[model samples]
Structures are given as structure tokens and as C-alpha cells.
Target: MTTDEAREFARSYVRFLESMHELAGRGEGNEVVRRVQEHVGEEGRRHSVVGRGFAPFEQVNVQVALDRWSEQPERTVVVEGVTLPPHYGPVTLQQLLHGEALPPTRLTAPELVDLPSGPGRTTACVRNGLFLVDDEARGRFVLFARAPQPHQGEPVLQLELAGLPTDEAQKVLRELDELRTRHNVYRGQTVELAPEMHGGLSVVFPELPATERADVVLPDAVLARIERHAIGIADRREALRAAGRHLKRGLLLYGPPGTGKTHTTRYLVQHLAGATVLMLSGRSLQLVGAVTQLARELQPAAIVLEDVDLVAEDRGFGPGSSPVLFELLDAMDGAAADADLLFLLTTNRADLLEEALAARPGRVDVAVEIGLPDSDARRRLLDVYARGLRLEVSDATQDDAIERMAGVTASFVKELLRRAVLEALEGEAAPDGVVVKDEHLIRALDDLLDSAQGLTRALLGVRDGAAAPGGGPEPHPHTRQAYASSLSFVAEAGPGLQPWR
Candidate 1:
């Protein structure tokens, strides 16, 4: 043969040998994995894979766990090609135990995600990574944390342990779970759990209004009752628990829509400083189970489910009748007697809530009615909303406004002051020093009471048939009839006398 041909043959033979060696060396700790698995398995030849899941709300929390767990001396590599399977999607580590084959994987730098750890705070967490953790306490094991992959059918943050004894896997996972709780981002913060389109929960940090005692315009007794149950009890929880008193309490606040049910809850939330406040309303109340479980992990927690009756059926609640309602009831009942947990439920339709609550008793220890504000409440609300405003109205005008505002809501009172300011701004009162006068206040009240704003009045929780309870104010004795209703009744009545449509 020619010298060039001989050289080419030698190079080809070297390439073949290199390929064989690489194939054989591809097994990284394969035997150790086998021993760990086979020891846990029937034959003790393969690795045993165990796993646990974290709710979508806990994405940041679990990331915190993995970050701390991997802080020790170890090697981490990103599990590449999760989308290489037949379905072309991400695969969880647990799939290994279910007979799924490990795809062609290359160890690469880990993929990490930066998430909000708190209000105006952020932290980095592993997205798709595996840890070859070898330690004296836990020994050698393969740990993986997989983020939710909707297309691949993984709907939650998943953690899996491979090649460890079954009992050992469980213990380590338990410790990790505890670590998650210890570093929970939602603990002692005011937040809402919002669901993603992919069926995972995302933590929402909402700035809850800071409400002081003076801001809550309910009757003194009513406000006192709320504080005693939600705040006062928590304050004395240690003493009460020492005396063997149960700290788990449920408070139900029912009233007409916009009559301060939610406002009252916010007041309670403000008082619950340093306690985790889970505020769920509307359709979000369906997440009672997840939120409640999280609350248990975060003690000194207050679960505020606003308008809870919205999720329950108007009829009886049997098995499968109202899963959301059932979950709510179960959550409240499941709390340990000594747990510092509070359930604050509010609903406009108390009648609808009565049945579901009756189905399972003792869930609510106290129920309070936050009805329409009385004359005194109206006066106080007017002054409260007008705090930062320049008021040029006389005492007589203020009394007239408050008396005319009977049967109205705290919301209505708040809007009244705002509308009065707008009225002043529109009528010769410059923006620089706009002073709300008696005329402006009267006109704004007239517009709100006009029949054209029927839905507006209802939305503000104003009862129909605008008549004050106890006959505080009679219809004006001298006034022109309204242009619309004049022909029907040409009697004397002022703008405030417009019959609530």
C-alpha cells in the first residue's frame, strides 16, 4: 500500500477506538446508582426514584429550598434534551420510576430563574437542574428540580430523588419541605394567589391599604367585635393557648354589597401586622384548599375569602355539590385547635351561605352583620373622606348632607365628598384652592340621587325608596317637580327627594 493510504487507515482505527472508550466511560456513577436503587428495589440492581410536588404558588419557595440544598459541596448539571422524547416535551425525574427512559442528556451549566422573593425583592432559583449530592448525612443521591412544563403535561414545580433508599428519600424530602416553609416568601406578607392559564398558581403581592382604627367607620361596638376576634385574639394567642383556649377562630361578615364588608376585612388585615394575609375574592375563592394548606405552613395567618357565597350553590351542599364550598369548610375545620389561624369570610348574600354553613357547623365561631351606615356613621364617613380636602361648607349644610345621605353606604359617603370636590372644580372653583361649598355638596348629592343613576345608586349599595330610617328627614315642602316625573305627580319635592328608582 502507498504511505498515504497507510496513514489514513491508522487515523480511522484511532477514531474507532476513541468512540468505544467514550461509550464505555459514559457511565457516571452508574453502579452506585444501581446499588442505591436495587437496595430499595426488589432486585437491588437499579436506582429507586422518589419525588414530591410544590404548588405553583410555591415556585419561589421551592427554588429557595433547592438553592440552599445545593449550597453544599456538590456538582450540578442541567439535564438537557427534556424535549427530545416522543411527545417532544419536558420530562420530570419521577418519570424514571414509571419506566420512562432517560433521553440523551449532556451535563451543562444549569438554567436558573430569577423570581420575586418579596415586595421589591428578587432571587435566583434553579429552573432545570440536577444535583449529584454526596454528603455524610444523606450519602450520595441524584436530586432534580423541574419547573412546570405545560406542553409536557407537568403542571407543578417537581422535585425528585433517585438511587436512595425509599425511607431515606422520604426523610430528605421531608427536611426539604420544612426548609421551604422556613424560607417561605408568602409568610407574614399581604398577598393573593393568582392562577395561571397553565393551571399553576402565581403569588401576587398586592399593597393592602393601611387602615387605622379611625379609618374604619363602623359602629364602635361592631368595630370592637371585629378587632377582638381577628386581632385581639391573635394578640393574646400565647396566653389563651397557655390556658388551653383554642386559637382557631372563624368570623363571617355578611351585609349588603359595598356596605363595608370588604373594607372591614381590610381593616382587619391591617391590624394583623406580621401575619400572613391571604386575600381571595371572586372566582379566586376556589383556591381555598391550596391557600389554606399554605396558611397552615404560615402560622399567624388570616385567610380572607371575600364574597365566599359567590362560589357556593344557592341550594343545598352535598358531596360534589360545591367543591369550592366544601374545600372552604374543610379548610376551616381542619385547623388544629391550638393553631393561630383565622378565617374571615364575607358575603352579600348571607341567605345563600346559610345552607352550606349549616351543612358543616362550627366552621364559623362568630357572624357579624355590617349593614348600612346609620346617621352617625354617615357623618363620620363624610368627615373621614374629606380629611385632605378644603371644606367651605357650613354646619347646617354638613348636617343636611349627612341627613340626606341616610340609607346610603360608606362607599356612597366617600364618593359624595369626591363628587363635591369635582363639582367645585367645575364651577369657578380653581384647582389651586378648590373649596367644597354647601352648594357643591348639595348639587353632587342631587346628581347621585337622580333617577338616571339607578344602577349607579345600586352599585353604591344605596337602598331603593330613598327614605331615612326612623323618619329623620321629611321630603322638602317647597320645590318644583322633576321634569321627568312632574306630570305623574306635580307635588313639591326637592332634588334630594327624588324617589330612589
Candidate 2:
């Protein structure tokens, strides 16, 4: 059957069972059972008598509030539709919510034999059904009853661990440990997500995983700039306050693609204490209200609205466009009021962004640009990618390759290395089996340079000795001299291109 049909069947059956059980418990046992049996058996003579489907369950109204916990932090879990017996207290509620296993007082699945146990039988509700209590001390249980009450909210699944026999308990605990082991935060020193608690409402940390700074090779100047900004934030810790009530606090990062714009933000989120990262792409802006709600809920978070330019810009809708933008503005303003909150924005087209949105006092506080990687950065990129590979080329040849690929972006360099290294490691098994040769490196460089489209932008668009292969205008003598002299480097090393990496 389709999922909806199955769900309907379960709900109906559960409601009937719950109603009958409640009636039977209140001394109308025989009559309640008779009525139920007849309702199912006689509802239709043609219907199968033994195995008719269940009826929809009606939801119970049970509310659970976490009053206090002496050992663990107090947390509330409202049992949406079911009502708990009066015997339940704050401690019991705590035990129910955060308990690692089912409690001894609760019934197990197998012990349930009938709806309401006759004379001296113990019973409990579980998983939208009922179970019989076999032994109070041993807490062994079995399914004997199935009640149908409407499931109000999703039930919190709990298993009884403390109630298990000694040997069985140990085995269960071992299994639990095994299950938990897969969620290690550190995998051989390369930080990764803790599996079980990866991402959801409270899993923003894993959702915005920490970025490895050493993974990307950045130009010295750009790296230095990032460090200085981080240091400045740290140094101003004591004196820094939230942007005043009128001024919001946000950060803007804009630069060419593959220049580590996104990487830097992720790293910042991982490094900052008590900082949750809430990522919102341009498309999510369609439902601005939901996004705003998330922002309010996850305060003291790094709310990164990447490519805000796409949605926040004045889209010529006049007054209609203001609603969503205004909502976003209010949310950002509220975040600014919280001293611990930090908002980050990233966009490739910073020029397209609304000036007031990014430049206004109550919004973005700082804007930093990330650009291409330079010559030194290119060398680092190559080395980083070739760490486990045994290159057949001499240091001089490798250096020449770096020089040849000097003007390329960091991502392109990494891609080139990946392709070349993979070609070299085709049939090797050793840790350092790959041998990258000068010919491979030269081939990679040639492909990258030849395939690269026209340089729409550059730190300085003066490529003098590097002939214009695409029939572009040649540089004048003075411009050529300036271009050639603009760079400085050690002989046989790589040319140190200024500014743009």
C-alpha cells in the first residue's frame, strides 16, 4: 500500500484500541470488549473476521515540562498528545527524556498480551502500543496489547537499558559504544563531522564544518591580512561592543572565485567561540520569513547570507521588494543588538549589491576582498598537492613549472596538480608511489594557460614578454619595461607577481 494509506490504517486502529483500553480500565471491561469486537466483526460480514485493518487513533493531550535536574541540565520535552500519569515527577520526566535506555518502570515491546491486564499484571504504553510487565525487578517485558490512540506528536523512542540483565546490559552498552564510535569528531587528525550529531537545528557546528586553513595556499599578503583581522578581533575583544542600537554588525567578503572567500568564513566560524554558522544561499531568500525566524533562534551565530547581492538588491519592484529586504534588515538589526552575534556575507559581485544594505551603519561592519593567488602561493599550492607524490623532475624543473603557471589561480593550480598526480599514480600502491615528471608538469601548465580565457581583470594587466597569443594589442615599449620590471624573483625560482595571486 501507499505510505498514506498505511498511515491512515494505523491511525484508525490505534484510536479504537486506545478508546477500548481506557473504557476497560474504568470497570466497563466486558461491555467495552464486546462493543469493540462487534464493531469490527459486524461492521461488515463480508470483511475478514480475523484480520481486519486498524482504525485511526485520536491523539492524547500530554504535556511534559522539565522542572529541574540535579545532575544534568534541565530541558523540557512536551509530550504533544499523550498525558502521563500523576505519579510522574520532574525526575521521572528527566529520566524519560534524556534516558539512554528504557526505564525499568516502562513495559517492553514483547510482554504486551492484551489491552488491560486482568488481575495482577503490570502494563505500560510504548511505541503507540501497550506491553505487559513480566517482572518488576528484572523489568523483562513483552507485547500483549496494542492500543490505538491518535498519535499527537512523534514519540521519543526509548529503550530500557538499566532494566536489562547484567550480561545483556553489558552487551547492549557495547553495541551502543560501537554505534557512537562512528561519530568521532577527529578522524586521524583530519577534523570531520561527528556522524550522529551532524546537522539539524542544534547541529549548526557540523553543518558549518571547520575549514582547514592549511588546505588552501594563499598569497602572503592576503594571508597576512586575514591574520591581522583575526588578531584585531582578538585584541579588541575587551573593548569591542555590539554595534549600537542604531548600527548593525555584519561582515562582507567579496573577491574573485577560488580566492578562499568561502574558506576564510568557514575557518572564522570554527575558530570563534560560541559561534554557530547559519548558511543561507540566494535561493532560500525566497522564503525570507523562515530565514528570519532561524536567525532569531540561532543568535550568537555567524549568519552567512552568501550572495546577498542577488536578493537584497533593489530589484525595481519599488515598494513590493522592500518587504523582504525590510524583514532581512530587521533580523540583522536584531542580531546586531546581541553582543555575541556575528553576521557574515559573501558575494562575487559586490558591485551589484545595494550600497545602503552593505554600507549602512546598522548592517555590515567590515568588508574584505579576497583575490587571486600570487607566485609564491602557486609554489605552495603545488607542493601541498604533491606532498605524497614522488616527482621525477628536479627542484629546478618544479620551480620552472611554478614560474610558468605563475598567473593562474590557486584552484586551477590544484586541479592541474590533481590531474597530473593521478596520471602518475595509475598503477602504484605505495604511499609515495606517484612520480610526477617535468613533462607532465609542463603539459599541465600548457593546458591551463592555453585554455584560460582572456584576463578580464588582474592586479596589473601588463603581460609584456608573455606574448599576446590571442591577437590582443601588444604592450608599448614603456609599458613592456614596466611590466617586466614590476616583478622580481630569484634566478631559476618563480617570478614574484605583485598584488594579484
- Which candidate gets the maximum lDDT versus the true structure? 1
How far does residue 11 in candidate 2 sit from its true spot (Å)?
A: 35
Scored by TM-score, the top model is 1
* C-alpha lDDT (0 to 100) for residue 415 of candidate 1: 89
Residues 446-484, candidate 2, lDDT per residue (tens digit)? 544442434421322323333233443233222323223
Please list all clashing residue pairs in model 1, or write none if there are none.
37-46, 37-47, 37-48, 38-44, 38-45, 39-44
RMSD of 2: 17.3
Tens-digit per-residue lDDT, 379-410, candidate 1: 88988999988898999989877777766778
Runs in model 2 lying further than 4 Å from the true structure? 1-210, 227-248, 286-299, 313-319, 323-330, 354-362, 426-432, 452-501
Q: List the lowest-lDDT window of 10 residues for candidate 2.
A: 58-67
**How many clashes (backbone N, Cα, C below 3 Å) per candidate?**
6, 37
